[model samples]
Target: MGRTFIAQRGQTKSTNDRQFRRDRQTPEVRYSIENAVEIFIHAKEAEGLRKSTIKGYHDTVRYFRDWLSHDIGYIDEITSTLIRNYINYLKNDRLPYQGDEQREKTKKGLSVFTINIRLRNLKAIFRFLVDEGIINKNPTGNIPLVKDDEHEEVQGLADAEIDMILGSYDDKQFAQWRDKTLVLLLLDTGLRINEAMSLTVDNVGFQQNTLIVPSEIAKNRKHREIPISREISKRLRQLVDETEQYFGEGSRIFMNAYGDDFTADAFRKRLNRLKKKLDIPKLHPHMLRHTFARNYILNGGDVFTLQKILDHADIQTTRKYIQMDSEHLRQQHNKFSPVRRLFNRKGKRL
Candidate 1:
């Protein structure tokens, strides 16, 4: 049976007859604990989160639910102290997948980014609880989120690195064709991994040379079209032909050789394998999307265009991609630097 939240009841004691017999109710049926998680999951789906994102939300909250059920009891008892303790538990605990060698290895905790994800999910859950009248106020309202220093360093990928990653893909290998296509789609369209994978044959307009990604498929459930580059178009046509040949007409543009839909875990594994072979660290699918925006901005693309391409709901959200490279910074310094061309190698005065 699927997990259900039963309101828990605390143990009770009652005095009986002249013998003074005490009646005790078992602790199991205390209060009717409404699994606050159901509300959170339903809310995200109602808002049209992508299938992958919905799954992610479900997983995060499911773990949280389990923790609350077993390690801690009573939803009302969830407090800031409990949340902090839960964070520490997640940080210190060894994952089930840890091998013998890794078992003894002093593994580090979740990165600030990952920690923030758990925090965000919990916060969303509490917000939903409040909206549903499960709780009068959010306990996580004032809790400070873990600050991520890595985000400052990982502004975006560099232009040269982008070229290297794309160039690393072997065009002639059929086995890696779909894999390469995934990278191409992310780089060219700036689509999230889930959005790119959800695309069916008809979603692409060969005549218009555009791909129509609908709202429900996107991260934020916003529809947008991204133009395909000439090179990407050629590869997509080949991939489309192969997909039709293998899976019949109107099939997905990319699929596993076994004709199954690509899973998120599989994609992560693929990228990790490729990263190991290429000697790169943290080569994630999002990095390709970031690479796209970074290179686009480097080559004269502006925030407006980037926002549309990246499908960001706000222009400010897109502005983060406008990070200038070292060369751009140097050029700006040479053009309008306060020091006026420091040494004046060309004898051009300010």
Candidate 2:
């Protein structure tokens, strides 16, 4: 069959639009750093980037301006030297809350990892400016990211601690069911709290035994499905039944008493109350995720599979679970090494 030329209008329109853009692409005026920051952020927002990401750009720009004492000029003035000084300043900046109410006591400065984050933000901004012809050189191209080892080891709940927390919930009542389901879902699926909380009744496919994470709620903006156990499916169905009865079929699975969708603040508040009631120190949403990852690693789940389960963009992020597993290996080696049998305490030549 020959090509059915249904409508060449879209192609013709796009060609004309590209030609117009090229004709009007000459931006000869140099934008002030402050003005360019807003332009770049607005551009990002226009491109449908996440609000959290755009907010980060705003925060970094505001911080960078404050660091400059509001004397920053045109975008062209941004140099490798200025960025280096900003990095040094970030290295030396301390927080008042790392201590007590004395206000005079300040703890050590931000960690290398945090400093690297700010530097990365700067890199993104300057790179954007360079692309737009608002700046001549990429001021951040030469600055190196901070080493990961500069931060403390990633922490997670132990297996016994997981048991303690899970056991703490009675699950006899509705509230208990909701709380336990929240915790366990995070553990089982490694779903971010926001992603889990965003679930509507329809998102939980009970028949298929899968929890569908829509792109809008997903961090990576890619839709994915999580396989659910029969028990989870049953609990989800029960929760859906109760929630729909209260707030109709359009109800969120994790709504508050007021029928409002659960927010991170609400989760934290509930977790804090639970912590105080149970007297457990370290219980939070992300720890449940870490626990999930650790458990997955120890139970012979590989990094690639865990990465897909966690919806991570890069496998390097998933590789941290290997380190957690290695820690367990070190403990096991110390406990049951057969080589220990040949060693004597008073070893001259046993």
* Candidate number achieving the greatest TM-score relative to the actual structure: 2
TM-score of each: 0.74, 0.78
Q: After superposition, how far is residue 59 of candidate 2 from its true place, in Å?
A: 1.2
Lowest lDDT 10-mer window, candidate 1? 21-30
lDDT tens digits, residues 81-188, model 2?
Answer: 888788777666655244457553465567776677777888888888878877667888988886655444466777667777778887777667788888878888
lDDT of 1 by residue, 1-350 (tens): 23333456763543333333222222323222345566666777898666767787777766766666465555666887878877877676734334556444566565666777878877877777766666655778888787644454344555565666778777777657678778877888778887788888778887788999897676666788889887777778889898778878867777777777776568888888877987876688877777778778766777788888888888877877666668767876677775665655587655
Q: By TM-score, how accurate is candidate 1? A: 0.74
Off by over 4 Å in 1: 1-31, 34-36, 39-57, 65-72, 91-105, 148-150, 153-168, 324-350
Instruction: Report the CA-based lDDT of candidate 2 relative to the real structure.
Output: 0.78
- What is the lDDT, from 0 to 100, of the residue 304 in candidate 1? 86
What lDDT does candidate 1 reach at residue 211? 91
Candidate 2: list runs displaced more than 4 Å: 1-28, 96-105, 148-152, 170-176, 272-281, 322-327, 330-350
- 103: Cα error in model 2, Å: 12
